[model samples]
Target: MTDTPTSRATLDQVGASVTGFFQDLGCELLEYSPDRAVVALTLAPRHLNNAGNLHGGVTATLMDVAMGLCGTWTEQPEQRRVAITLSMNVNFSAPAAADSRVRAVARCRSGGHKTFMASCDLLDESDRLIAFGEGVFQRGALRSELP
Candidate 1:
C-alpha cells in the first residue's frame, strides 16, 4: 500500500509508543512494509554541527533506525528479532540544510541466521540524496527464550 500522511503519522505514534527514543530525537516513521521503511526528521538547529550542516551522527542514527524497522517488519509476536549494528558505512553526498525535511529510506539487502544487511539513503525534501549508508546487523536469539 502507498504510504499516506495519516499512515505515516500513525507509524510515528507507534514508534513513539514503542520507544521514547524517536520522540526524543524528533524522528518520525513515514513508511513501513515488509521490505523497507522510511523515516523522516525535520532538521533543527540542534541537529547541526559546527560546520553548519546536519551532523553525520544524526544521519547515521536515522539510517540505523530505518534499517532496524525494515528488519522488524518480519517479526512475529511469538518470535522476535533484535539487531545490533555490526558495521555501518556512510557517505555524505551533500549538506542537509537546516529547517528542511529529511527522509531516510532503508532496504533490506540480505539476511541469514543471525545477520542482516541493509542500505539507506538520506534525502532532502526535493529528493536530493544527502547521504547514503549500508549496515550489517547481528540478530539475537528469540525473545521467548531469552532472559
Candidate 2:
C-alpha cells in the first residue's frame, strides 16, 4: 500500500518504541511494508568525516537499518519479527554533504523461514544515488531463550 501521512505517523510511533544506536544515528522511518522500508535522515556534523563528506559508516548504518526493516516487517505489524545482520555489501557512488536530506529505500529480494536478503539505495535530496547496498540477515528470537 502507498504511504500516507497517517501511515507515516504510525511508523514514527512504532519507531519510537525502538531505542539505541538507531536513535543516535537520527534516522526516521518514513514508510514500511512487508517487503520494503524507507528511512530518512539529515546529515549532521557528527555524521561527516574529517575530509568533509558524509562518513561511510553513516551510510552503512542507514543501509543496515533500512534493509533490516525490509526483512523484518510482517503483514501484521504486531506479528513483526526482528533480524540481525549476517553480512552487508555496500557501494558508495557519491558523497553527500553535511545537512543534506538523505533517504534510504530498501527492498527485500528473498525471504526464507530463517533468513532473508535485501537491497537498499541511498539517495540525496537532489535524488542522486549516493550509496547502495545488499544485505543478508538471519531471523532472531523474539525473547530470550537462554536460561
Q: What does candidate 2 score on TM?
A: 0.87
lDDT of 1 at 5: 34
TM-score of each candidate? 0.81, 0.87
Clashes of each: 0, 0
After superposition, candidate 2 runs with Cα above 4 Å error: 1-6, 76-79, 142-147
Q: Mind giving the per-residue lDDT tens digits that candidate 1 earns over 49-136?
A: 9988999889988998888776666333334445678899999999987898999999989997778899999999999999998999
What are the RMSDs of all candidates, in order? Answer: 4.0, 3.5
Q: Which candidate is the best by lDDT?
A: 2
Across 1-147, the per-residue lDDT of candidate 2 in tens digits comes to: 545333755587556644577788888988787778888999999999998899999999888988988877654454446778999999999989988999999999998988999999999988899999899999875532211
Candidate 1: Cα lDDT at 75: 33
